[model samples]
Target: MAKYLDSNKVYRALAFIDPYGMTVNWESIQALKGLGIDFWILVPTGLGVSRLLKNDGNISEAWQRKLEKFLGLDRQYIIDYFYQRRSVSTLFGEETQINKEKDIVTKIGNLYTERLKTVFEYVSESFVMKNSTNSIMYHFMMATNNHSGLKIANDVIKPKYKL
Candidate 1:
């Protein structure tokens, strides 16, 4: 998997080929392992960038950089976003418009999820991968930049601490 990773956009990608070979997914999985993580909290699990590239025929550089930043952020917020989130309530806070926007974000995310499912079949699509994931770890961040949720989260979090 290291070979696949080497060609991707991750700035400092790492993978272990010892004892049993490691895909960085190990780190993410560990984060969610025993924290009573429920589906509602984490919603769409997995990294969100490189993984989503295949489906996005013409990705914008801005979007690419955004996901890179998301990966760079600690997974602590990810788990916290879900399991400990008062997130939804705060956003949909007695506001019909917020509810409407929330619904739209959900639908968009589902579309991305469907697109991501077949990414492996098109691994060859990336100019970098060039049909090489058959033997390497690619840090495909499959997480969406779900701006709606992110904004809500940022707002909710700021109240607990200064922005």
Candidate 2:
């Protein structure tokens, strides 16, 4: 990413980590700033699955409604869609889940409020892109949806805080 945009003199970059923002490590942010990006915005979009169908049972109706509202998806039309998922390991079995309501919302907010380390460095450039018309509210919505998953990841990456 830096190589391609470097030549263009694009001094700054904004990576859409997930519509549900990302766990930003300020330490890494300082490092990336050294790479010449004056600033970067983590405009997260929960989980993108444009290749798949529209409706998905794993996701809830309210989740669908919120995602549609954020992504400009029409409410009248329903279709299978994708949202980031997580796994909960138990003594008996592991559960794969997507927490669209309360869980997702906070995982997204931690990007700004909480500080992480390695999670900040991995770009997943294959998945990141630039938004021509970026808005804070939109990014907030995205972050809210991913909050739960991000919190799980945050805990895994920073396990010292775990209960």
Candidate 3:
């Protein structure tokens, strides 16, 4: 896309990025900023991010690196955003325990939307997609420099599925 943008020809593109999981790098999306592109991305909030976030907040180094690369945020910031650190008195002593936040899927979606807002002029409401067991698996969101594109995305995203 950056290559095409450098060309003299005027081009408007509509891109749908549906990764199998949380494999897409943040730099790829950042490259689309200020370009004439309408993008719809499938964020695996539940299937990927939420699952990677362990309940005890003791994520492995590899998983932490993956999250940081995908979300473009610091590991500590991501941990703090998704978990609450509380001091609990154990039988031996006071221990700091990190508890995962409630409704992580929504939080992940909101966080992604906020990140998208940093690059796009207009970001449409998310369309939540659930799995067969009714668990939230992904969020389909559209980002564009044009307001009309946002409106069209809103129109296409059903009310019930809006997040």
Candidate closest to the true structure, highest lDDT: 3
For model 3, residues 1-163, the per-residue Cα lDDT tens digits are 5667534248778899999898898988888887888899999999999999999999999999999999999988999899998999999999998899999999999999999999899999998999779899999999998898898999998675433
TM-score of each: 0.18, 0.23, 0.91
**lDDT score of residue 36 within candidate 3:** 82
lDDT of all predictions: 0.29, 0.36, 0.90
State how far residue 75 of model 2 sits from its true place (Å). Answer: 26
Better of 2 and 3 by lDDT: 3
| RMSD of every prediction | 19.7, 15.1, 2.4
Q: Which ten residues in a row have the lowest lDDT in candidate 3?
A: 1-10
Candidate 1 TM-score to native: 0.18
Model 1 agreement with the true structure over 42-120: per-residue lDDT tens digits: 2222223333333313336655444334333333432232222123344547422111122222333443334433321
lDDT of 3 at 5: 55
Off by over 4 Å in 2: 1-34, 42-103, 111-136, 139-163
For model 3 the local lDDT of residue 156 reads 90
